[model samples]
Structure formats: structure tokens, C-alpha cells
Target: MELEGDLFSLTNLRNMEIIDINTGAKLGFIKDLKINCEEHKIISIILPSQTFKISLFGKNEDIEIPWDNVKKIGVDVILVDGKNLVEE
Candidate 1:
């Protein structure tokens, strides 16, 4: 399915898994997605539970994975560049 349609169809996207391309490791579930309403482009992905301490400290670091880093969108997961996650 197309990316936009796949994303919108998901009801509870916050719990959907996201994968790291290089290591094939599950990064985390998506907490939220940043989208540009005017351009209708995805800006970043927010993984709220990746770091427990950060979440506790009231700093939910949303890993801003640019649209270019997205490898694919599956039925229940989003694939992204592992290098980008590591670099952050």
C-alpha cells in the first residue's frame, strides 16, 4: 500500500513497531508522527518510550527521522535507516 494510506489507516499507530534497517533491531513503537499539513509531507517520527530515563525526566526526545531515511512502510511497521538512529 502507499505510505500515506498505510499510515492513515492505522488506528493506534503509537504502538506500531519501527525497525532499524542496518541491524534489523526493533527501535521502538511510534509515539507520534510530525507532518507538514500544507506540503503533506512527514517531517519526523516520535518514539516516546525509547529512553525510560528521558521520559521520566520529562524530556521525550522525538527522534527526527527525515522522510528520506524511511526505507519502507509495512503493514504494521515503519523501516528506517539504522545509521541515522545511531548518529543521533
Candidate 2:
């Protein structure tokens, strides 16, 4: 996916899913992306929840997966190493 130019452009990133490589489980959708200010590279991914938990204070938390853990980026999903993902 060629994500260049306008950062807010949702043309290429609507309804994309992020998956766990080890188990092939659907983690969440791509809510937004954080880019590094100096290097201009993607620093982390944002995953807004489709469901909510009361313990989380009723606010959606974005799952910040560091760029280094990303194993691959696929057409429909972004895959990451499962061992590094935090469990609930």
C-alpha cells in the first residue's frame, strides 16, 4: 500500500484488519497510524476497539505496536509476531 502524501487520506486504509502471525487471529482494525517526526517513518499503529471493557475506564485505547514487531504487511491485514503481543 502506497501511503504517501496526505496523512489523513483514508482511501487506502479503511476497514483493514491487523492479525497475529502465530495464531492468525484478528486483533483489530487500523484506526490510525503514528509517524516519527524526525525519521518520517511509522512508529506505531492505532487500534480503536469495536467492543468496550469497563475496566478500561470506558475509553477506547489504541494498541501501540512498535514498528520493529511488525512481521509483515499484507493486502487485508498487518501481521505481527504473536509472542510480542500483550495478552488481555
Q: Which ten residues in a row have the lowest lDDT in candidate 2?
A: 1-10
Q: lDDT per residue, candidate 1, 35-86, as tens digits?
A: 9999977777766545655546677566666667787776677788858552
Question: How accurate locally is residue 39 in candidate 2, as Cα lDDT from 0 to 100?
Answer: 92
**lDDT (tens digit, per residue) of candidate 2 on 1-88:** 3323334435445466778778888887776777888997877776665356445566664566666777766566667765665322
> What are the lDDT scores of the predictions, listed in order?
0.67, 0.64
Question: Which candidate leads the pack in lDDT?
Answer: 1
| Top model number, TM-score | 1
C-alpha lDDT of candidate 1 relative to the true structure: 0.67
Clashing pairs in 1: none
Deviating ranges (above 4 Å) for candidate 1: 1-7, 10-12, 55-57, 86-88
Model 1, TM vs. native: 0.69
TM-score of 2: 0.67
